[model samples]
Target chain A: MSEEIIIAGFGGQGVLSMGKILAYSGIMQDQEVSWMPSYGPEMRGGTANVTVILSDERISSPYLKVYDTAIILNQQSMDKFENTVKPDGILLYDPNGITHHPTRKDIKIYQIEGAKLAAEMDNKKIFNMIVLGAFLKIKPIVKLENVIKGLKKSLSERYHHLIPLNKEAIDTGMKHLKKFNIEKHIIHN
Target chain B: MAELKLMKGNEALAEAAIRAGVDAYFGYPITPQSEVIEYLMAERPEKRTGMVVLQAESEVAAINMVYGAASTGKKVMTSSSSPGISLKQEGISYMAGAELPAVIVNVVRGGPGLGTIQPSQADYFQSVKGGGHGDYKLYVLAPASVQEMSDFVADAFDIAFKYRTPVLILSDGLIGQMMEKVVLRDQVERITDEDLIKTHGSWATTGKTNRNRNIVTSLDLQSEKMEARVHRLQKKYKQMELEDLRYEKIDCDDAEYLIVAYGSSARISQKAVEIARKKGIKVGLLRPLTLFPFPKKQLFELADQVKGILSVELNSGQMVEDVQLSVEHKVPVEHFGRTGGIIHTPEEVLDALEQKIITHGHFRNHKTRESSIL
Candidate 1:
């Protein structure tokens, strides 16, 4: 199976790291994976994005204009990538600071209030892990054990103590994701 | 045993250089490629293999350091982006003149001047056409993947020492920054001083030990001597073209149209080929591994099989000239590019192929988007 995904949000939201962890999970399963981040000025406290591809066969490109899934974390990203998802593809987002919801009828849409959940959990940093967990719940492309291993690999040794908390956040994310009916979407000219 | 790990192209290349018995790396850090030096500095290859990693004051100083280290027959290398590479041109020319064996990496960024720190293939002409002024050619390797980025370190060093000329690993910021799974090779021990003296004693500047000094310089005052030196350099280049040319062909057996690309562009074009074939369009990709030896002969042969050829690059259109020259206009050759760090998508490449090659801009229904672009 080949899954091309784009994870996008404001720079500090761990958008890039979520993609990295996903890519690492793919590697743990011996699948070919590529993680390409947008490393321009936009990454500095502005909108940041990374294109992650997990494939059974050799991956052809790391940079893609369209994706099988778009994991959006902010209004800017939701506004931009909602249309880039392939028809019948998945659009997962966190409705924390988002104003405009996804408006595509051809693609499946889901929401996880990552920021609010992280605040309730009293650990703001696990917001991305929560979003990642939500994504895995829908796709299950990678096993949980592998995702844990990937999280360990992505984080430094000093932060290993936080894995359990991250794991909890991930579980919460999986439990809390809500899907949109996606009926009668308004078309923008 | 080969160990597999996910790594950025620049990091993988640096790790591979350490494993491949590199003696020293002298470089100045630049965006997109700074990780090469950063990884090397952090790994402390000196502790592991007695290799030296130094950050020079400037790009010029770094390249000169490479020239100095290589003159002593050491496995040496340096890396930089477009502007920094431009600053090192003089030193690169000096290395070429002295016939030094060293590996240089250009993780290219957009530029005529300090343009942008974004990935670009604009350096294609600068790399293959002798960026440094002189009668010399660097055996250029254009790596398309992180695996190749790791693997080509040893390959470039091999070509550098085998031919007694400098070799360049021509990469771009995209490949440099992208991370992927790469199988790391087992570490090879560095060449001992005794082995170094014995192997390169004939031409190296290892000091006058019980004999005449082995002088290393590119200077020959006599006109005929200079002519001979240039001819010898040319002969080496010819040998490289004959012996070590590298390329890859995908889905070309039944392809009606071909896309010629290298490095990261090849990866994108490969996807485009897959999409085109899925749509029942007979398309293929030709990826040139060695830019200097260039798959001209192979491209010429493919011209006979394919009805059209599209040269895809991240530049305004440098390699397109070479593509045209390769096929001698046997088939229609056109260029599609996205400069200033913009990468074209797979669909965009296919659309360009359709508009520019398949139809050849003849009998099209509308203005062809060229007017809109203009």
Candidate 2:
């Protein structure tokens, strides 16, 4: 199985790191993975995106045309990648600053109020993890234990204290997301 | 068990050099490849293994530093992007003439001048055809994956020493910036011997311990002596062509059409091949690992079986000429590419194959290797 995902948002929205954590989790689970970020001028003040691919087989073409899942954060990303999602694919987004919502009828759309939830939890950095938690709840490609291991691997030793907080944020995100019940899922993750 | 880390290609190249017991690294920072020096500074390989990592004032200084260090038989290296690499061309020629062993890395970006910082394969001709002013062929390795970016460090050094010639790791911004899971090799012990008499004793000027003093010079006043030196270099390149030519063939057994590409273009073409095969087009991909000792004979042999070949590149069209030369117009060859920093998609590559090779082949003359666009 292979999953090609694109995570897009403004410069400081944890767009790249979310893909990094996902790549690490895939590695921890013995899956082949690649994470390619948009390193052009768009990364400065404009919208930034990273393409993450996790496959049981060796992955090719890190620069993808479309995505199996698009984890969009801001309005710019929602406007950019809303229609680029594969038909019957998943489009997970945070409806914090998004004025225009995704209206694709074929793909599944899920919302995680990451900014609101982060404000509620009193930590703005956990916004990415909350959105990640919502995606994982719908499609549990990686386990929570391995995500903790992935967090330990990605973050330095000083940030180890905050892993539990991120874990709590992820649990809150999974609980906050109303359970997706589409029954016949075409794509597994 | 293997030691693995998820690292960007530039960081992986730096880490692999440190783990390979590289003696010193002297490089100026450049876009799309600054991580090579940045990672070495942050990791402090000096404390770990006494390796010296210095930031040179200029690209010229960095390459000349490599020349000086390599004369003493030290495993030294430098890295930069397209423009910076152009500045080091004179020094690279000197190293080639002196028959030194230094691994130089060119993480290419789009360039006719100080072009975009985005990834590109435009340097294919510049590198393989000898960017420096000389009749020398630099040993070139084009890696498609970040794992190969980590692995090719040791491989380049080994080949450099084995041939007593400089090797070039022909990577682009894509392979340099992309992050992926890389399995690193164990740390190799650094060379402690100052003289290095056992390995580089014949030519290295290590304090001139014995015999006649070792002389390191590319300049020979006598015309015959210079001719002999050139012949020696040419012989070595020929030997490399016979012994170490590296390439990969995918799905070519029953292929009706062939796609030839290298480096990042090869990775994109692999996906295109998969998609085309699913659409019932029997297409295959031939990826050249060593761009200098190109897959001429391999491609020529494959030409007898396939109807047409499409050379895919990130540039406008450079490697296509080599593809034509390799096959000698046995089958129809076409060039399809995207220039500047724009990368081609898989579907676009497949479409180009159908249009340029299949549909257009019947209307055009097969003898013309020079593309019409040029």
Candidate 3:
């Protein structure tokens, strides 16, 4: 199975690192994966994005025009990637800064209150891990154990002490995710 | 067995250089390729394998430093982007003329003149056709994947030392920035001064002890001597062409059309080939791993099999000229490209293949028929 995912948010929101963790998790699971980030000025403080592909076989292109799933954080990313998700795909977003809620009927839309939960947890940096947890809850592409191992590999040794707290944040995000169901249209007589 | 690690192409190149027993790295930081030096500095190759990693003041100084180190028969390397590489052309030419071995990595970004800090194959002509003003050729290796980016450092050094000439790793921002799995080699010891004296004692500038002083210079004022030097370079180039014509052909057995590309463009074209094949189009991809010693013979044979050849690149058609030269009018050769760092999608390439190559075949055949009649 192959999964093409786009993770996007503000530069400091850990969007690129989240994708890296996911890619590392895929590797730990013995899957072929690629992580491509949009580098340059946009990555300094503006909107940032990364395309991560996990496949059982070789990945052909690191760049993609569309994605099977889009995990968006900020309003800018939400506006840009809401429609780019494939039909019958998944769109997971943090409800903190998104102004316009996704209204697509052909795809599944879910919201994780990552910012609020991270604020409660007293560490805003774990916001991405929360969103990642929500994503895994819905998709389950890689196991949680593999994600923990990936986290250890991605984070430096000094940050190893925070893995438990990050793990707690993910669990909270998974518990707090709310699905937004598209209303079915009624046929006129 | 060595462990697999997820790394960017630039990072992999740096790690591989250290593991491959590179004696020194002198490079200036440039976008899309700064990671090469950054990794080297962080790893402290000085402590790891007694390899020296220094960040030069500029690209010019970095390449000149490479020349100095390579003159001593040390395995030296430097990396830069397109604009930065342009600054090193003179030094590269000097090294080529002096017959000094070195590895230069150009993690190419878009350009003619500081175009953009994005992935581009625009440097194809500049790289393969010799950017510097001299009758010289560099062994250019085009790596399509992160694994190749790591592997080709050793290969480039091998060829560089074997022929006592400079070799270039022509990569792009796409590979440099993108992360993928790579199997890194185990650490090898850097060549000691004793080893250098033993291997290249005759020509290397190693203290000039017990032998005639070996002066290294590109300046031969005498026309006849300079011409002989040029002939010697030409002979070495011809030998390289025969020995290092490397390419990979995918799904070309019954292909009606073929797409030729290298580096990152090849990776994208591979996808385009798959997309076209899924739609019942007999399309194939030919990726040149070596750009300078291009796989001309293989392309000539494929020209007879395919109805048309399309050269796809991120530039406004640089390598297409080489493709056309190789085909030699045996088939129609067309170019489809995106300039200024804009990457084309697989669907766009497939559309170009169907429109510019397949559907226009009748017109090309008609033109050929008219030309034959004339």
TM-score on 0 to 1 scale for chain A of candidate 2? 0.92
B211-271: candidate 2 lDDT, tens digit per residue:
7977888898999999999999999999999998899999999999999999888989999
The CA lDDT at B283 in model 2 is 95
| CAPRI level of candidate 2 | medium
Per-candidate TM-score against the hidden true structure: 0.96, 0.95, 0.96
Lowest lDDT 10-residue stretch of candidate 3 chain B: B200-209
Query: Candidate 3 regions off by >4 Å?
Result: A184-189, B197-201, B368-374
Per model, kept true contacts as a fraction are 0.82, 0.73, 0.64
Which candidate number has the best lDDT?
1
> Can you list each candidate's DockQ?
0.78, 0.75, 0.74
Alpha-carbon local distance difference test for all models: 0.91, 0.90, 0.90
CA shift at B213, candidate 2, in angstroms?
Answer: 1.4
lDDT rank order: 1, 3, 2
User: Candidate 2 clashing pairs?
Assistant: none
Model 3 lDDT per residue over B217-243, tens place: 899999999999999999999999898
- What order do you get sorting by DockQ, best first? 1, 2, 3
Positional deviation of A31 in candidate 1, in angstroms?
Answer: 0.2
Candidate 3, A24-83: lDDT as tens digits: 999999999999999998888899999999999988888877799999999999889998
TM for candidate 3 is 0.96
